[model samples]
Target chain A: MLTQRQVRLAWLLVLPTLLVVVLVAGYPLAQVFYWSLFRADIAFVEPPEFLGFKNYLYLLQDPDFRQALWNTVKFTVFSVSLETLLGLAIALVIHSNFKGRGLVRTAILIPWAIPTVVSAKMWQWMLHDVYGVINILGVKLGILSQKVAFLARPELVLPAIIAVDVWKTTPFMALLLLAGLQLIPEELYEAASIDGATRWQQFWTITLPLLTPALVVALIFRTLDALRVFDVIFVMSGVNPATRTLAVYNRQTLIDFQDLGYGSAISVAILVLIFLFVVAYMRTLGREALR
Target chain B: MRTWLRLGNRLLFYLLVVFVVVYSVFPFYWAVISSFKPSDALFASDPNFLPLPFTLDHYKNVFLQANFGRNLLNSVVVAGGATLLSLVLGVLAAYALGRLPFPPRNAVLYLVLAMTMFPQISVLGGLFMLLRQAGLFNTHMGLILSYLLFTLPFTVWVLVGYFKGLPRELEEAAYVDGATPLQTLVRIMLPLTGPGLVTTGLLAFIAAWNEYLFALTFTVGDKVKTVPPAIASFGGATPFEIPWGSIMAASVVVTVPLVVLVLIFQQRIVAGLTAGAVKG
Candidate 1:
């Protein structure tokens, strides 16, 4: 399994990728870690002062960071769960006999393919209070007595954002699950039906078990993406703590507020949280995803 | 009773299908129609659902008036450059990892995948500092370099599976012809990677094009700005005005080509996506 020539060849091939990754990923990661120790406020006319553990200590008590953490968890949990359920339903439906199946699949990719910024902006226009179509449609359809501002209110912001996310990403989840659905043999379903196993029973005992790997992988990907949510929320509500995510709050601190060290600390906190999620998933889910 | 049940099931299935299509396509349709409408019509209490009496003023504003075309060009350059570089590096790494018995091979693969999971925020400050120090703060090259974080890992992860999927007999024949591993890869396996290249390259281009935060953070001037940030920053002449028409037009302009590409390559894209996830 171990050959010197093979190892040399592989390194020769992989050298450039390794080099770029170290520069773009590894070095920046190290720099963030290093800066987490200092108080690097760019707004002041002073050099960064080393203040080990202080930024992190303050971060532990930071109200904004806490709110962001809560918001991220809420967005991640709600959006991922909804996307999974809807994605699963769509996959199952389209997996079986359906007219225009290819057309339906292609139709769904439109939402997923539209740029996130465009999605946010388009929805922003639609969710406008006075002249927006969503409000207009809601009133006309008797879903609402009057127009409602979807993005401005604290109560509705996360839900509005989740709806937008689900719209954009459910197709993606459906595609992944559909791929998993295709992997299971038709014979299994045929034999089960012959054995008098109802479709529901077949789904529970066979489909669900076989789909767990794809489902788990999809969850991990979406969770990581949701955990780092930005553009959509940022575009809809600019730095509003009502919907500020981990990345948003970090951007506010680091870029907007110019608290580089404190921002780096926030960045490290986010890094660790995601790191923990990956590690935990690898531990419990048994790394079927890696295969 | 059985006939009634079958009829109801068909009706429900068709109903679900309609809902899915409308839900997915309606907003995009709305965006297109809105882009064509005049400002006065847009502000009316009851909106026109159709693009009647359409005006091209918004498109005029986006092209003739603003620097959107330049921004689009910047996006094309950056996305194109990053995709080309990523495909080259990814192909190299994938071939080596898929074929060779290398030490730390598995570790490298894990590392490549791990980069995607890294909190991009963790690297933002450092990347900013590095770019500024290198005098590449607002350059397309810098944007392309920084985009390795997103594009490279994806290409490598997807292409690894593509490389692995190739039959071993080809490689053995190349070896029997006294070809070195590199020659076998360059001459034989490389030629067969046409489809894999197209899929990964298109996906990478799309990823680079859609990126916002990094572009927003890195570039400060209009010359190097891309569509997402450029569109985000579009506004009316006054603080009270939002220029909804212009924003919608810009959105439509940048979105149509991508939507077409995705529709055309939907099958390959699905293959690429599942390979990234399920095949590792």
Candidate 2:
């Protein structure tokens, strides 16, 4: 339906964006791939050496990489699951036609608007070992006798980070689900009620099916973000190997250890893993164009 | 039986709303209060909800001693620059995809989304090297470019949806009246999609302002360091203990603008942002 002139103008319009992407994203990505084949220096002054697949081989054997990969998986599963559940609950509450629902909706988004660093910092204070509100309440309530280092211990670090993720992002999930909830006609529920449907029955037959699409979209977005979890853990636990995810590990490899080739391989690996997940997710939801 | 059940459901709904409201708002309220509390009150054996011996010392220190004002100005400039850059680029790209019969439109969008999922760490290695070679390593321009990795993709995706949803007849009418393509786009399309642009622009601004990874990785000295990194530095555990009051004060400085903005545009922001995913 478009004329040749319109088409030309369209291409002209997109040129600047395409150029920026090529220069910034495209160039760097190509450079990383190129660097992956070279002997990237750990020390600044070493001359570059050709190392084909050697860097990737070394990375595959690295214990830290394996551990970080595991931690990322664990964090994604726990954080996304909790966020979806809590988000659905919160959304249902806000979606209902109740007094002050608007106020509640506004209130929930405050946490989401606050930067990740600020949220993590606040929680760090709350989770501090000695005088934190969490420990204080814990001891008073007989949850723990003595102070416990939440981020200091490796096993506890992932859970703590996941908890923050859940708290911060559940509101986002709620917002998305609430929007979806608005789309479902009230007449369907009214008809169900007229049919003498029980609350559980209405939920199972009406709400669940109608809400599935929103849930899937929320899941994909959350999973994608969780897989790239960095800022929260990074700000809370700086350079702590025990708590580092793949992102933190990749950062350490490049910035801390100055190993460009190994870091790029890790980055590429994470990209492939996330892309696979996204493809599967989109196909399952029948929304592949969402890519 | 139905009446009893209706009554019970009503009670449960109210209960849930109350609980959610309290849970959501309490931490923010506590943060504001804690910011005002005296340093002694933070450590007192008995803590109250209110800052009894109130003081402005923490705020004063945040402004004067911590150089929070400088960081705030830097955040504004960086966030403003990123917003403007992404808006201009995003609007153009979105217009192309929405109106023009471009081959591989869907593929390009998918690629953009995939790029968004590209983790910040992956690009840091090569980007650091590239920036160093180009002599932009510690510059604001370097930080801004890194943030575009996030802001640009989102702007294009969101704005494309917004532009597509708008009626094309408006632009067509303008063209018929002798407005050129650029003029029609500016005079006709831009004004119509004002809300969409602002909504997406605000989201981009917040992301840039809040960015932590590149800001920390690229810039070291306070000359270009941002609020997030500044906040982190205040709490670094040295031989001396972390300063909780100062940290809280700094958080207040960082979060206050975001809080005010959200409060003002709560409706448009919530609706505009969620519209992209849900409506799409």
Candidate 3:
């Protein structure tokens, strides 16, 4: 029920944002699609020659691209699952009546507030083979026979990166889940307790089901972020190949190797994968909500 | 038996709380302590939890030798400029979406959200080219423009939510008083959404400040580098040396302000984040 004048004013108001978005995001996105179809190398003294689908064809055979895709999937699955489980536990604990609850919440947010690169740098020093406190801690706790090169070892590097991601992002997940936990009416829990439900039963039947919406939202956000993770891997293990996610690999290809066409192909592939994930996730969540 | 079970549960809860606190706070604590330790003490055989005989050498090195001061200034300008630009554009768009019954409102909202989720790397190649063409590459303006890709969408989404929640009666009354939509927005709505503006603005500032990939890609020289890249590329006298103490000092310098702001606005930040995320 709006007048034409109001509608025109609305369009006028939204014009600036729309223009900025188009200039900054929309135009570049179209450019990415255009660039992906060529053989362009900025470092090479030659112009871009269109090679429709050739760049993507090469990507199909690129072992590094495959490995990066695998690494990204592995990182996303492991980190998001671990973060969710740990976040749930922490959220449940903090949701309860406790002394210093507010203080604990603020403390946990410190890690999230710290820039990712700084956290990665801090962990790099803490994981140093010789001078690291983690090694010293391991030895004292009887967990290790000697200092282990956590970031250098191929088997341990990805896990080490995952551990750092878990530490930095678990609090964010907990915060989101805690918000969801608060929305569950207290009377529901009270009624369950009055009906002779055990604590564990109440949790399984009440908390898990009621927290699904937040859980789904948090999972999607974390998964999307984890898929394109760059800062942690870049700062911690640059071009290591062992822990290179798609975003890091894409940067290496574009900036380091100057392979513009190939890099754009990778970027487009990532966008496609993420879009599909989001669509499928929203669809399933929509169905669940309907049920 | 019931009393015993209750006691055990209480003990476990306390232990879990302690673990959460220690895990979250200890890294920053250790970083601060390490920043104050002398080079020799840092590599000592025994790791000290506390900085015994604290030294300011690392801080001095960071400021005097490492060129971190310039980098900090760059981060402030880029992040601050981006925040201001996005807030202005976002408020107008959000006001439109929230107040006016515009056609395609949902489509516009979804478009903005989709832009936020798009992988930043996807745009790096194109954005780099665009910036170069516009003669903005390696400039603060380039980074600011690139950052709008994230900040604008986020600001619009959060502020839209805020504006929707504001009382409609105020705008109607203003309308009856012969106030235009723009006038109502500026004269009436802006005053009411003060807290929302602060929350959204702070979150946008934080995002731009912490941004890494674009800053790393867009800027090259020490003149234009931000804290993340500067800290990442920090080195010692030798190629093999890492200069951990100085790096920790720079980290402390870059992080302490953000931690203080986050602590002060913890409640509002949480509100804005959840409003943008969970509600959507």
Candidate 4:
């Protein structure tokens, strides 16, 4: 179907993107993998010595790394599940006819648009032990007996972080699901109604099955992001061992401690975990799509 | 009885809408009002939701004392430069992938998507060494190049979808007139995909502006630092005091422009974000 000139032209056009990707993404990934096999601490005068598998072995025994791995899993599971449910509800509500639908849609996007660091800082203020509006309101409304330090308490920090993640990203999930919701033919719903299907029955039978693709995409994206979450956790908690995710721990190891080998090992671990998640996600979705 | 049930459902639906709007809007709204309060008023025992007798001192402190104005300029230059570069490269590649009958096109597209999934920290150590060797460390160029990691993938992915959606008949007509492929793209397709360009460009700019980890790791000097790091490193006049007011003010300054853009291009943004995901 194609001529020789078109193939040549296509290659010509795609060359630059390929080159940039190679220089930036490809080379660095290889370098990270290579670096992970050595003991490369920059603070010492010695050059990096090869210690194949030792760095990864050290990480398996490292308490901080294990804690970080656990924290990342907890964060991803809690935040993604909550966001999916809340986002589905929101998308359903916004899909219906309303007078100020445009305004509501635009308003909801503001949270998503704001930079994560800024939102974290804003929430930091609101979660302050003293003078925080959240504490003020909680006390007044009898939700708490007195002011509680939301981010400072070890028991509460992870939940607090999840709440913020849910707040910022539920809109994005909703937007994606809303697009899927809109794609369903109106006739299907009308047909269901004529068959005396209840509202909940129509939702279960027609809406959910059709929305599965979008749900998969949204879940994968959010889960991946949650796994590597750095900005909010770093800014809000600052290397607090309790709240550190894998990405933040990797940064601290590489940058602060100048432990290149250990950091790259952590990086590789994170990548492997994410890869497994993506593979599982694709397999399930592929099977479901065929069905 | 049926009417009552319908009325109850409507009330619950309206209540859910109200909750969504308020939950989304309140934090930013609170940040804006808090930015206007004086430091003393902000720290008052009873928090004032409204900024009574609002002051601009915090804004003044951000611009004058914290030297945030320079950081704001740095953000604009870096984010703007990255977006423009990615857009140029992305359009060319997207045109090929979307229009040309190239073998392995799906593979190439998926490869780009895979690049986006690589956690940034995994690349940081190698990139730091490479950039330093290239004499780009702590430079805007380094940050810009690194930004390609995210921006290029997103731009190409979105634009490919946009290009695919264009009518094939238009390109065929141009070819019949003896126009070259390049000529058709420039003279015809470019004008038609204006909205796509805006959507992709805005998203790229926002991503680059909001990037924190790379900017924090790569750049060290105050002169090169972007707004996120600048705000992160901001300190009170005294070491013992935290400048919440000035910090809030700077947060407002950095966020307002993005909020304005989102409001203006709400529909386009939603379309661009969902296009690739839903289609895939």
Where does candidate 2 chain A have its weakest 10-residue lDDT segment?
Answer: A282-291
lDDT of 4 by residue, B1-280 (tens): 9999989988988888899899999999999989999888998887777998699999998898877988999899999999999999999999999998789798999988888777888898889877888899889899899999989988898899889999999999998898888888889998998999999999999999999999999998777899998888778868978798999999999999999999889889998888756554
| Candidate 1 residue lDDT tens string, A26-126 | 88888788889998874445798999899999999989999999999999999999999999998987898767988889889999899999999999999
**On residues A1-291, what C-alpha lDDT tens digit does candidate 2 reach at each position?**
346777788888888888877767888888788888887764457787888888779878999888888888888899999999899999988887778877898889888888999998888877877766677778878998877888778778778878888888999999998888887899999999999998789989988888888788778778988898889988888757777888888888888888777777887877778879977887877463343
Estimate every model's Cα lDDT from 0 to 1: 0.90, 0.82, 0.92, 0.89
TM-score of each: 0.97, 0.95, 0.98, 0.97
Please give the lDDT score for candidate 4: 0.89
What overall lDDT, based on C-alpha atoms, would model 2 receive against the true structure? 0.82
Each model's fraction of native contacts:
0.82, 0.68, 0.79, 0.79
Point out the higher-scoring one by lDDT: 1 or 2: 1
TM-score of structure candidate 3:
0.98
The true-versus-predicted C-alpha distance at residue B256 of model 3, in Å, is 0.5
Query: What are the clash counts of all predictions, listed in order?
Result: 0, 0, 0, 0
The DockQ-derived docking category for candidate 3 is high
Please rank every candidate by lDDT, starting with the best.
Answer: 3, 1, 4, 2
Which residue runs does candidate 3 get wrong by more than 4 Å?
A: none
For each candidate, the DockQ is: 0.80, 0.69, 0.85, 0.79
User: In candidate 1, which residue ranges exceed 4 Å CA deviation?
Assistant: A1-6, A42-44, A287-291
Predicted candidate 3 versus true structure: per-residue lDDT over B1-120, tens digit per residue: 999999998898898899999999998999999999999999987878999869999999999997899999999999999999999999999999999979989999999989878889
Compared with the true structure, model 1 gives a TM-score of 0.97
